[model samples]
Target: MTSAPARTERSRTDGPAEPHRRRRMALALAAGGLVLGVGAIVTLAVWNDSEFATGTFGAGSFDLQGSTDGAAFTSDAAAPGKTLTFTLDADTLAPDDVVYAPFAVQLSDTSTNEAAVTIENVIGGTIGDDLTYSLFIEDDFGATCSAATPPAGAEVVADRAADATGTVDVFDLTAAGEPVSLCFVVTAGAIGQGEAGTITWEFAGTSGDTLP
Candidate 1:
């Protein structure tokens, strides 16, 4: 009797099993890796755009006055006839930088009378040699009146010896009704990284026939 027909060998392709689950797992892993890489790049970009630090610098001002007309006469010094006050503010400034402030005075008057004025720098004290300043004068018509050197025994004060910071007071008399204007030039020394702040100036003076 003939043996039962030989059974056909099962072929790998003929089976119901497939690589679908493995392929799906691989695709999911690749997509996850791409998302992680993009997230890391975005995080780095944001971190680089932020500022580590910041600061600001500025100056304080005072009102100018005159004795005679109050409206006609003006002195570079504060409230002409009163003690002038100057305050320096060095806030948030880099420790290495220097600051400087320059000042100029103008006098004007409508009357024919001539006026005389003087400016002084009073910081630490007179005897201690702690004060310093330069003087410049101009007439009502903006004409140069005279130039003078630093007063005897006067010291030029500065935040740093190499770079100085201070004020200039201008004193002068006007004719009678003319107008006068004063200008101040301010400067800061080589700023170091991270230094920031403001400088304040306080001036008080009296407007009279003569300077005190």
Candidate 2:
């Protein structure tokens, strides 16, 4: 008899496409993981550079000294400074009488700049009305300051009454101990009988000394 043909068994090639799709997905996941690892490594890497800076500072000095005699110098930085070694009878002044005194000034060796000196005022005297004075600055070095006369190069600073107020004159001094010599000549102005007192003159000095 004519029997029916036996059914052929299903083969692997004839199965559903699900297994192929799963294999492709696994490969894609593996590639994504590799890319993530490379990105993390790049983020962790770093580069660096730098620089630095720094400074120093200091202060300067200034000091003034005086000499009553032209030889020995000292500081008289207070009111009623060094007493004058007058060449006349200063304690017994009379009409038309004249007296002389010498003084000196310099910047201390420790000073950093040159100086300017001014006659700020004259004070403390009842006899001032009858006393007129003159100040002279001399360029004569190594010579004794004298009341008889200043050096030929001497210049008069002021010829004011002893009680004159305000700035009357100005002078200069070199830096680091160069001395400027001065002579004072005071004259009596019709002084009264038995009228007497003392006077104080102010000598103010400053840095960058100049003359006018």
Candidate 3:
């Protein structure tokens, strides 16, 4: 009779605790699933990442021209390994005769640099002290050289230097299609006639980008 009375009421209170524990377990499982979903989305976004870009680079060119009496020859372009040569009009000379050799220097179409004119070589036969020359630069705007005004002196050669290498800073050819003017004065010094000589102008172009 005692054992039958105890077994009757023990089963009823355990029902509510079982359902509460089941609800807490369901909420934890749902939160863990949401966290996993968020992690998957973040992993996908990181896997699909990217970057950007830009351009390229190149080099420049240098070229020049030498002219006498309106005829021009480009350096390294007119002929292979050939320098431009011009003849001076010192064919006839007398004592105290100052001859003006008007000439022009031009930078080629592809030239993008400043240039210098050097007296590279000067040779003569038997002029003695009669054939002396002076180099000058002109500020004339005309394409052809003008003799109306006196030229600005840059270098003077009293006698032919066997190694004549001197530079004259003429007008710079920083822009394209622009040219410079030069002049040489061969003065027959105090000596006898029947003399002849030759002068060579070496125009060397230097890039503006490499200038000091």
Candidate 4:
């Protein structure tokens, strides 16, 4: 009896099909990993580049000008009545800046009665010798005044008061001109330097007159 035809050996091609399936699976896993890595990089870049905060900065600047009319303690033997004019200027300055201004004058008396001679006597020539007169800008805030030299014939005194005033002795007066200046000094609470401000002084009296 013819035994059942031996079954044909299963085709050996099935072995090759198993390896192909494994390769496809591995390719799919690698693609998925690559996609995940790209997504993570994109997220980090966006977080770092974003503008999370904001801020602002600003700045500003100032100047001072001053003038006086007469010097030399008003000439001796001058008219009884004379007036002196003074002017001050505050240049453009920052709001934070502060300024202080002070001034002084020199005078003298040739007459023996120093008590009888008044500012007028010095100005009028009633007292011929040189004398000094001074005015101070009250220090509303504690501050200092700047020092300056007088004209060629004038002399500047070295006396300074804590109250923002300066003084010159009668002997310091010159026949030439008065020493004048605008002082810019820093005080507590001042913001910065170069702030502009001005100070002025005016004198009016008879040349030979005296003040009470």
Candidate 5:
């Protein structure tokens, strides 16, 4: 009876300790999750603060200057029906009397493109019938028509066959004052003339995208 009396009920506190431990573990997990969420929110705010700022993008001229016998043309305006008239100024134009009339066509540096030059629609005067003329172009390129050497190029622009057109290679102008020369060596014909002869004609310069 004495041995059995010592067996008292020991209340096991260890059983309840497990639930407290689980509660502590759950609280630690929740604390860790909260910390991660706060860190993620901070990272998101920092990333969202970055921003990016707002962003922003003509023709050339083709002009020409023309002259006759070293004198500038009356008007540089070029169009249909426009003409340059060269009149015989000598008191008497005898046979073999050669007159060298130096003419020039200038292209300004402001012109962005090369021009195609042409002479057309030559209407001769009554005196022109009795006279014959030869046209020559200087090979030496410059602005001045006054060249020291005689023009050697034998190109006939006017003769018994009066109506003839002449053309130059599409070329760029030297400068504003500089020009290519077109020399007319007009000679009196063997046939005698009645009145003062005249040569009335026009020249045209056109520029476009066409290439040589």
Candidate 6:
């Protein structure tokens, strides 16, 4: 009888063991591939660079003030500003009568910028219609508004009807607080004996490095 195919001892021993060894080798190779992918990703993350920047800042100040006596400076920013301390009978009225007052202007000591100042408006009440007025600048804080004629070398800023509007002159003040002395001369114009009222003058100042 034909004998069944021989099973060699080598075949029996190698068949199953060979398949198991191959599976273990394939698992080791797959783990090695995963480790290589993780290493490459980490290398990309480590190779990096960057940059940045920043800043700082601040501001300045401006102010204006007035003095009626040319000694004590203050702000009279609105209508009916500091009352003009006129010489002679300011309250009394006769034709051709005249009176004088002293005033001064300057930038405040702490002001950080220079200015251009103006006599922006003049308004009169009941007595305003019956008066004429003039503004003059003098060298000293003491006034010459009462002089029979404007003082020698005096500068006239305004000579107009008592009831007038708009700026008559523009003057300058340095940031270091230089002073400008002013004089007001008011004359009666046949006003009635019983007439009495108020007058207001407004000064406007603009802060700047150059005049505006």
Clashes of 6: 0
Q: Which ranking of candidates, highest lDDT first?
A: 6, 2, 5, 3, 1, 4
Off by over 4 Å in 6: 1-8, 43-59, 153-156, 210-212
Candidate 3 lDDT over residue span 1-212, tens digit each: 44555455656777798889999999999999999999887743335666888778766665676555445544543222343222334566667666666666676677545555344444445563345556566665222222455455444333443334556444456655566666666566665555554544555556665322
In order of appearance, the predictions have TM-scores of 0.25, 0.74, 0.52, 0.26, 0.49, 0.81
Clash number by candidate, in order: 40, 2, 0, 20, 2, 0
Worst-scoring 10-residue span by lDDT in model 5: 140-149
Q: Cα lDDT of model 6 overall? A: 0.73
Superposed model 3: Cα runs more than 4 Å off: 1-55, 70-89, 116-119, 124-130, 141-163, 190-195, 210-212
Kindly report which residue stretches of model 5 are placed more than 4 angstroms away from their true locations once superposed: 1-59, 68-75, 78-91, 139-149, 153-160, 163-177, 208-212
True-vs-predicted CA distance for residue 150, candidate 6, Å? 4.0
Global lDDT of each candidate: 0.37, 0.73, 0.55, 0.32, 0.56, 0.73
Number of the top TM-score candidate:
6
Of the candidates numbered 1 and 4, which has the greater lDDT value? 1
**Model 6 TM-score (2 dp):** 0.81
Candidate 6: residue 61 lDDT (0-100): 56
Global lDDT of model 5: 0.56
- List residue ranges in candidate 4 displaced over 4 A: 1-5, 44-212
lDDT of 4 at 108: 36
lDDT of 5 by residue, 180-212 (tens): 667665666664655564654455667754222
Which residue segments of model 2 deviate by more than 4 Å?
A: 1-53, 139-151, 209-212
Score candidate 3 by lDDT.
0.55
- What is the TM-score (0 to 1) of candidate 3? 0.52
lDDT of 2: 0.73
- Between candidates 2 and 4, the one scoring higher on TM-score is 2
